[model samples]
Target: MSTLTKQDTFQSLLDSASSSFAPIRTQAKETYLTQGLPALKEEEYKFTSIAKKLESKIQEFKSALPFAVSKEDIESVLFEGFDGDVLVFSNGKYLPELSTSPEGITVSSLSQAENTPLGSIAKPEKDAFSALNLASFSDGLFISVPKKQKVEKPILLISFNQANSGQVIQPRVWIEAGDFSEVTFIDHSISQTEDPYFVNKVVEIKGGLNSHVNYYRLQNESKNAIEVSNIHTDIFQDSRFTSVNLSLSGDMVRNNLTLNLLGSNSEGNMYGVYLLNGKTHVDNHTNVDHTIPHAESNELYKGILADQSRGVFNGKIFVRQDAQKTNAFQQNNNILLSEDAIVNTKPQLEIWADDVKCSHGCTVGQLDEEALFYLKARGIDKNTATGLLLYAFAGEVLEKIEEESFRSYAISLIQERLGSKF
Candidate 1:
C-alpha cells in the first residue's frame, strides 16, 4: 500500500462529492494536485504564509456535517436598513426561503444557467485556492441583467455559516451585466457558530459594452474561521467597474482581486479597508491588466493594525504592449497602532507601452502623536482624538461607497471597533 499524501487525500475528498460540474471539478482537482498550495517563498506570496495556515487546518476540510439556519436567524444578522434584493446561502447551499426574488433581472442556480456565461470569468489554473473552490463548490448564485435595462436597486448576497467543528464551505457567485446595463452588487459573509470552519469563495463578474457595475464585499466571520476568496472581473468597451472590500475580523483571510481591461476606453476602480487586531491575519493581492488602448485603472487600500496583528498588501498593474494611452494608479497606506503590530505593503507597475501614465506608491507609519496632542489640547479626550484621526484616515475609502445606508452602517461598525462612544 502506498502512503496517502495530502494531495491524494484532497483528491479523494473531491471524488466523493456529486456535482453537475464534474468535468470542471476533475480538471481543477488535477491542477490542485499538481500545483498544491502556494508557499511563502513564492514572490507573489512572499509576505503571506498561506501554505502554513492551510497545513495547520488541513483536517477541517475532510468532512463537513450538515448545518441548517432559519430565516429569522438570517434576518437577525443583516445590516440594519438595507432594503436591497437578497440571496441567502447557508453552509454553501442556496436558501430561497430567506431570499427576496430580484426584479428586472434573471436569478437562477449556477447549474441552471447553462446557456449563459457561467464559468467564463474564473481561471482556476492560475491559483490553487480558486481551483479548490471550483472542485468543491456545492451551489452558487448566477445573476444576469438584460441589455439596456438598469437594476433600480442593489442586490444583496448573504452567506451564512452554521458549522460544527472541522467543516469546509465553498460559495461561488457569477454576475453578468448585459450591454448598456447598470447594477450594484453586494456580498456579505457572516458566521454564527463559534466552531472553527473554512470558507473558500470565488466571484466572477463580466461587464459588457457601455455597462456599469458596482460591487462591495463585507467579511466578518467567526474569529476562529479561515477564509480565502478570489474575485475576477472582465470589463468591456466603454464600461465601468468599481469594487470595495471591507475586511473586519477573521483568523486568517486571503483575498485575490484581478481586473482585466479587454476593451478600449474601459474604467476600473478598486478600494479596500481592513481593521485587524489580536493575532488575526489579512492579505490582499490585487492585479490590474490593461490589454487594450485608452483604459484607466485606480486602486487604493488602507489598513489599521493593532496589538500583535499582521497585514499584507500587494498591488500590481500591467500594461500590455498594445495598451497605449493607459492611465493606472495604485496606492497602499497602513497605520500600525502598537509596537507589536506588523504590516507589509508593496505597489508595483509593469508597463510595456511608452505612451502611458502610471504611478505606484505605498506608505507605512504610526499614528501622528502631534495631531493627537493638538486634538487633546482642544477639549477632546485622548481616546476620542485617536478615534477621530483614525476615522479621518479611513474615511477616504468609505466615502467612495455609493450606497448611503451601507456607508452609514459601515461607519458605525468602524466607530465601535475604534472604541469611540460617539
Candidate 2:
C-alpha cells in the first residue's frame, strides 16, 4: 500500500466534495497539483514558502460549522467610534442582521448576486485558492456604488472567526465602483476563539473609468490562526486604486495583491505594514501590471520583526511592450528588532517598454544604535525609545493614508503592537 501525502489527502477531500461544485473543485485540484508549492526558485515566490507551511498546517481543508457568532456579538466588533456601512460575517457566513447600509449603496450576499447582472464579477478563476473559494464559499459581500455618485461613508466588511472546534473558514467579497463613482472599502479579520483554524479569503475589486477606490485590510487574527488572502483589482482609464495592508497577528500569513492597469492614465498604489512577534510569520506578495500607455504604479512595504518572528515581502512591477511612458516604483524595507528575527525583502521590476520609467529597491536592517542612544541619553528608557523609533519608521508609510480617521485608527493599532501608547 502507498502512503498518501498531505496534498493527496486534500485532493481526496476535494474530490469527495465535488458534487457541490464539481468543475471548480476539479480545476482547483489540478492547479494545486500542477503548481505544486511555489518555491524559492519561482521568481514571484522567491521570498516566501507558502506551499511548505500550507502542507504542514492544513491536513485537509474541512468545512463544518463548529460554532456561530450572533449578530449582537458581531456588532461590538465594529470600529467603535467610526461611521460606515458595516457588513459582518461570522465563520464565513454573512450575518445580514448585523449589517447596515444607507440608501444609494447596494449590499447583498454573493449567492444572491449570482442570480443578477452583478454575477459577472463573481466568475471563477484558475487560481487554486480562488477556485476553492468559489466552489465552497458559504457567504460573502457584494457592494456596488452607483455611477456618478460619491459614497459619503466608508464601507466596512468585518470577518469574524469564532469557531472553537478548529474548523476552516472561507470568506469572499466582490466590490464594483461605477464610472465617476468614489468609495472606500475596509476589510477587517478577527478571531474570537483561541483554537487554531484557517482563514481563506478572496476579494475582487473593479474600478470603472474615472472612478476612485481606496481599499484597506486589517488582519489581526489570533496567534494560533493561519490566514491566506488574495486581492485582485482592475483599474480603468483615469481611475485610481489604492490598497493598504496591515498585518499584526497570525501564526502564518500569506497575502497576494494583484493590480491591473487596463487603461491609460490609471494609477495604482500598494502599501503594507507587517509587525510580527514571537514565532509569527508573515509574507506579502504583490504585482502591478501596467498594460497600457502612461499608466503609473507605486508600491511600498515595510515590516518589523521581533523575537523569533519572520517577515517576507515580494513586490513585482511589469510594464508591457505597449505601456509606453509608464512610471512604476517599488520599495521594501524591514527592521529586525531582535537578533533572532529574520526578514526577506525582494523588489523586482520587469519592463518590456523602453520608454517606461521603472525602479525597484529593497533594504533589511536593524534599529539605529546611534539614534537609540541619543534618545536614551535624554532620560528615555530603552524600551520606550525603541518603540518611538519604530513608530517613526512606520510613520513614513502611515502618512500615505489620506483619510484622517482611518489613519488615526491604524496609528493607534500600530502603537499598541509596539507596546507604546503613542
Candidate 3:
C-alpha cells in the first residue's frame, strides 16, 4: 500500500466523517494546506513548537471508539454543590442525555444548531482549528441565552476524556448571549484516562448589546496529556465580558484567547493562573482588539513553575484608528521555583488611535531572596516560605475570581499543586 499524503489523509478523514458541515471541512483543509501548519519561524509561534508536535502525532489518527462514557461518568466530574444547567461531552461526542438547560436557554448539539437560524454564526473563518472543529466535530455544545433574560445559575459545560487507551479528542462549544441578558458559564476539561491523550478544544462566545457574560475555564488533564484551547469572544455596545482561565495539568498546554470589542463603551477582563510541575509546559496567548471608541480591557496572568517546568505568556492589546479613548492594560508575571524552571513572557500594545491609553508589561523572576530569608528567620522552612511567596505572587489573579466557591476551590487546588501548607 502507498503511504498517504497529508492532503489525502485530511480529505479521507473529512470524507469518512458524517459531518453536517461539508463546506467548512473543505475550507479548513484548504487553509491548512495553504498555511501549512504554523512553523516555529512564524512570529506568533516563535517560542512554541506546536506545529512540530502535531506533525509528529498526525499518524496516530485511527478509527476506533476507545470507550463509551455515560451520564453517570459526568456526575462524577461535577464540582460538588454546583447546581445549574449541564452539558457533557465525552471524547468529543456530546451526550444529550447528560445535558440539561434552563428555560429561555437553548442547548443542543453543534450539528443541529448548524441547521437552525443561527447556522450563519458557524461561518468558516481563517482560523484553521475553528474550521476543523466545524467540519469534523461529531458532538459539541451550543448555548443560546435568550434576550433580556438573566440566568440565575451558572451554566456548566464539561468535556471529559475517559478513554482507556491513548487517543485524540476535539471538543467545540459555541455560546450566544442575547441583548440585555446576563449569564455565567464554566467550561471544564477533565481526563479520566491514564494513557496519553490529546485534546483540541475551541469555544466561541458572542455578546449582544448591554449584555453581560462571565466565563470560567478549568483544564485539569493528565500529566501525559496535550491540550490546545482557543477561545474567541465578541462584545457589542456597552457589553461586559469576563474570562478566567485556570491551567493545572497536561504535559503541554496552550491557551489562545481573543476578544473583539466591536462596539463602544464595552469592557473586557481576562485573568489566568497556571501552576506547573515536572516537565509541564503551558503557554497563554491573548489578544484584545478595540474597534470602537471608549472601550476598556484589562488582563492579568500569573504562573508558578517548579521542577524544571516551563511557562510562556504573550499578550497583545490592539487599538484601531477609530477606537478613540480606548483604555487597555495587560500584565504577566511568573515565579520560577527552581533554577531549571523557565518563563518566557512578552506583553505588547499597538495603538493606532492617538487618544487611546494602553500599557503592557511582563516580569519573569524568582522568589525574592530577601523575603525568603525573612520568612526563614521567622522559623519557616524553605519549602513553606517558597510556597507562601508563590501563593502571594498568584493571589492577585486568584482573588479576582468573584465566585466564592470557585475562588476557594482554585486556591486549594493551587496549594495542593504546590504541595506545601502555609
Candidate 4:
C-alpha cells in the first residue's frame, strides 16, 4: 500500500512469468543482476551508452507494461503492399488477432511452447540486454519450420511501438529451422509514439543442416526513438545464412549481429545500408566465426550520412585453427554529404587457420566530386545528380537482396529516404 521497492517490483515481475521457463528466467535474472547494465568503459558499448539511457527511464519503462492498444494504432505501422504473413507486436505484446502464418511454418506463443529452445544460441550470460529480455519478456512468439519444407512466402515480423512516450519495450523472438528447410524472415520496427522511447530487443535463430535462411531487418523508428537490437544466429553444416540490415531513421540505434558457423560447408553473408541525417546516430556491429573447415563468409555495409548525422560500423571475422579452407571477407564504405556528418569504421580479422582466405577493410570519405560534376555537366540538375551519385554508392548493398518483392520495397525505402535529404 505504501511503495513498491525496485527489488520488490522486480521479484513480482519474475514471479508472474510463465513457470515453464522459470529456470531460464532465474538464470537470466541472475545474469542481469550480476553483470548489471553495460557501462561506457566497456569496449563493446563505448560508443553507445544504452545502459545509462535505459537506467534513466527505468520507471517510465515499468509503467509501459499493460500499455493500451487500439486497432487503428497497430495498423499504422504495417509495411505498404506487403501482405504475406505478418506477426504483429504492439509494445512487445503479440497480437494473435492481427497476425497470420503460412502453411509450412508453425507459430505459437512462447510461454506455452513445450521443450522450447529459448536461450540456446544467445545465452543470457553473454550480453546484458539479452539477459534483461530473457528475464522480463512477459510474452513473445516461437516459430518453427519443418524439415525438408520450403516456405514460398517470407514471414514478416512487425514490431510496432505506440504511446507510452518515455516507455521501454523488450521484444524477444526465437526461430528454429529443421534440417533441409528453406525460409526467409523479415523484421520491421516502427514507432508511432511522440516522445523518446527505448526498445531492447533480441532475436535468436538456429539453423538446421543444409538449411537456407535469409533474414532482413529494417529499422525506421520515429525521430526520438532509441533502440538496441541483438540478432544472434547459429548456422549448421552445409547451411547458408544471409542477413541484410537497413538502418534508416532513429534518434540513436545500435545493432549487434553475430553469426556462428559451427559446421562444415556453411556460408554466411551480411549486407547493410544506413542512410542518416539530422542528429540521428546509428551503429552496426557484426561478428562472424568460422569454426569448421570448408566454410565461407562475406560481408559488406555502406552508409550515406548528411547534415550532422553520425554512423559507426565495426565488423569482426574470426577463423579458428580447425577452420581450414575458410573463406571470409568483410568491408564497410561510407559517404558524407556535409562537413558535420561523421563516420567511424573498423574492419578486423583474426585468423588461426593456415589454409584460410580472409581479408577485411573499411573506407570513409565524402562523395566523389568528379562523379557529381560529371552528371551535373550533362543536363541533370545539381540535386538530381548528387542523389544519383549517392544512390550508386549505396545501391550495391541493396542489389544483394535476392527476393524480388522485398528488394523492390527496400529500394523504394532508400529512394524515399534520400529524396528528403537531396
**Candidate 1 ranges beyond 4 A from true positions:** 1-9, 63-66, 116-119
Residue 40, model 2: lDDT of: 52
Judged by lDDT, which candidate is best? 1
Model 4 TM: 0.92
lDDT of 2 by residue, 18-66 (tens): 3543455456555455544455566655655555665566555566453
TM-score list, all predictions? 0.96, 0.90, 0.92, 0.92
Residue 287, model 4, lDDT = 92
Give me the overall lDDT of model 3: 0.77
lDDT of 2 at 189: 82
Cα lDDT of model 4 by residue, 1-422, tens digit: 11222353345444555655778888888887777667778777767676555545444354246455566755665556665787888788787887876787789888767788777888888787788778877777889999999988888887778746555687888899999999998888767666677788888999999999999988889878888888999998999999999999988899989999999999999999999999899989999999999999999999999999999998989999999999999999998888999888888899998998888898888878898788878988887777777778888999988777678788877876666243
Worst 10 residues of 2 by lDDT: 117-126
lDDT of each: 0.85, 0.78, 0.77, 0.82
TM-score attained by model 1: 0.96
Q: Candidate 3 — which pairs collide?
A: none
Compared with the true structure, what per-residue lDDT tens digits does model 1 show for residues 262-295? 9999999999999999989999999999999999
Tens-digit lDDT track for model 3 on 1-422? 11323464345445555656666556665654455445666677777776565556455443224366776777776666677878777687777776775777888887778553222333335444455555555656678898998998877777777653335577777889999999988878777766656676777889999999999888888887777777888899999999999998887788889999999999999999998889888999898989999999999999988898889999989999999999999999888878999888989888888997788888888889999999999999988887788888888988877666667777888876675654
- Candidate 1's displacement at residue 346, Å, is 1.4
Error of 4 at 154 (Å): 1.2
Whose lDDT is higher: candidate 2's or candidate 4's?
A: 4
RMSD of model 3 against the true structure: 3.0
